[model samples]
Target: MSLLADVDFRRYWLARMVSLTGSLVTYVALPVLIYSVTGSSLWTAFVVVAEGVPYLCFGLFAGALADRLDRRRVMVIADLVNAVVLGSIPAAWAFGVLTAPHVLVVAFLTQILFVFFDAANFGALPALVGRARIAAANSAVHGGGTVLEIIVPGLAGVLITLTAPAPLLLVDAVSFAVSALLVRAIATPLQTGVPGPPGGMLRDIREGVVFLSRHSIVRTQTVIGCLQSMTGGAFMGQFVPWLDQTLGIRPTNDARLGIMYGVWGAGGIVAAVLFPRLSRRLGEPRVTLWFLPLSALAGLACGLATNWVVAAAMLGLWAIVYSMVVLTAITLRQRVTPDRLQSRVNTAGRMISFGVGWPVGALLGGLVSEATDPRTAIIWTAAMTGIGVVFAWLSPLRRLAGEPIPDADETPTPAQREPVPAPDRIEA
Candidate 1:
């Protein structure tokens, strides 16, 4: 079916686009603000760390909660909380009360809330539409976000030039508020076909872990994703520093970084447009295996680039291939997993891959960048990314020809099982 035929998907896509634009605004503004405040690159890195750490810590728990709760409500609460927290920064700045400490604190809080929002989002999607449409839905979602990533940064760069970071942050806050409202408007019911046992949070967490362990496809995908994230984290963290220090581009002064991000987004947009068609032709797993290795090589080439033009070209290719791999993976997971388990499985998958890998990779990248040249770090990261290709190659997933696409009768599992209310004994 055409993506346009799905009104709910359209609403979700539009909401995500608005939210992503705000996210991009913050993405550009935060580093600039932190740098302006401290004039220390190290401090800026620390802020980045602060933003990611909480997500890593809370991701699994958040996933379990998403499965247990009303996903739309979870999304609404998450967006509202973020809107308030994000708004506080600008308010503080306007009152001359925004301090470095305030920034760090807010960054941490924002990440914490974001972890929950992200989990709910992943968990919620399969329920909103169905497993059959996941690929197309994901394309729209990723495509919209990619388009924003391309446009918003340019807008953000212009905005930064015209005003201070605080105002941009204020705009971001409003976007979150709007996103919350949009989420609230989604009228679809979310009911998991398989319910978890009544248990405490720790018990629920354990169940999620056990579920993942038994699910081979989910397990394999998670491992591959983790490794990819590790490499990506290392590349992003170290590549700029290397370019600045080794290639003689001023990382701090140049618009090269912005160009890199924009090009990457452009690549993602291309991939998102092509993914559904590509999956149809090559099958998802084969497409993933083919593209991932090539993307890794592109990453390696990106590390080797000595000039902005070459680097931008390589990064753009990397982004395109990376987007294809990610889109393929998401489609595979959504298609194979039962609906009731989708949120938990999605959370479990991300927790193992992204939640664990990002901070460790970033930390390692920083150390490697500090001890050697950024190029060296990038090369090492590229090698790691390439190594992940082995995981894809060896797994049963590689042999997976696209199964017949799911249809309406094939009810995938839900994100959570309906709770059995207290049993009432017959008063006879």
Candidate 2:
């Protein structure tokens, strides 16, 4: 059967699209809700910090859980949990129980569940689609989700005008429920190839870390990823306030940020769709090497912008290149890692890279933006991201263009097993 004809894939894709649209709605509504309650930029930053901190704290544990349990069940549970939590916001508001503290608590809770959902979703993909199709499958998912990014903000804007942001939370809740049902309908068990370590969760976590540290490619990729995320986080955390304060554009009035994000999502979708063929042509590593610098330049451009239009355009460029870089990175990681260790390794990578760096960078950005000019903060962040381009150019990963990926049919040779370490531990 044609890949497009795969029943499970179709069901899962449809579900994700529906849920993503709703998520887009909340992404807009939540901020608006928070801003309406407290008209302070610091509170806005606090909300951002609240959302990011939990992911940093729980990312590794969530990944280990994905490795140990049925990923599908985990995903379903996460979706349902999110649905219920998000669904409560509107109800609370209607009952006059909603407050700034309530919004903060709900935002924190929703993000925590989101991290689990995200980890399980990635962990489950290999089992559902098989390793060979990972790039294409991921591309399709990213592409479909991008399409929604373009539409959802406008939809949310319309909804917000007609009703309070509370009712929009119900839409998010419904989306999650639908996603859960669709995920549950898939009958295929996610094939976890082998268990990593037998002892406690600590041991299992340690083994995963040791494995990643030992792998040169994984180690380098993780380091670069971390740097990229740190810089990206700093920029994103500041961009809203920067635009609002420096450009004299209010967040609600200027939907250009949403447009910029949609453009970025479009870039990612385009990269994902074209990556397989591009990898075949330019070679995966070479493509990354070429694009890495371009992405940095895009960041630099975003920093230097003085006008809203220029800033939005620069952000769009950055979004496009950044999407390509991420798609390539994820594809390479998925291709190289063994099936059994994929979740552990992916989690470890994220834990060290994005999970850790995002909050730190964002917190720093918030502080810096408050202390100095937001544009200055953005420029520094952009400069830092550009510096990573030199590292990429010097690494052996740069020379890996057109190299043939190992055939999946080959069995993985047994490597020395390391003792499991404690949970939430990260190395390299």
TM-scores for every candidate against the unseen true structure = 0.87, 0.88
Tens digit of lDDT per residue, candidate 2, span 1-428? 25558999888888789889888888777867876788755566666677777777887777777777777888889999999899889999989888888888888898898878777776677778887888788778878887787677666766666678777889899999999999999877765664334347776667677767865456667777777777777776665577677776565655564665566566566666677787768766777788888887888788888887887777767877787777777776676666666677787787777776666666677677778877777777777766568887776575444355452344322221223466633322
* lDDT top scorer: 1
lDDT of 1 by residue, 1-428 (tens): 47656677667777898888898888878867876787554555556567667767887788788777777888889889999999998899888988888888888898888888877788678777776677888998888889887888766766676678776898888999999888888776654453345557676666667656654455667788888887777765554456567666543445555666688889999999999899888877678789989988998898888787888898889899988887877777767666655666677777777667765676677677767767887788788886789888987565454444332235323321122233521100
Q: What are the runs in model 1 whose C-alpha is more than 4 Å off?
A: 192-200, 239-257, 401-428
Candidate 2: Cα lDDT at 168: 84
Lowest-scoring 10 consecutive residues by lDDT in candidate 1?
Answer: 419-428
| Residue 415 Cα positional deviation in candidate 2, in Å, after optimal superposition | 17
Residue 111, model 1, lDDT: 84
CA displacement after TM-score superposition, residue 322 of candidate 1 (Å) = 1.0
Cα RMSDs, all models: 6.1, 4.1
Question: Which lDDT value does model 1 have at 306?
Answer: 79
lDDT of 2 at 303: 80
Error of 1 at 232 (Å): 1.8
**Residue-level error in angstroms, candidate 1, position 320:** 0.5
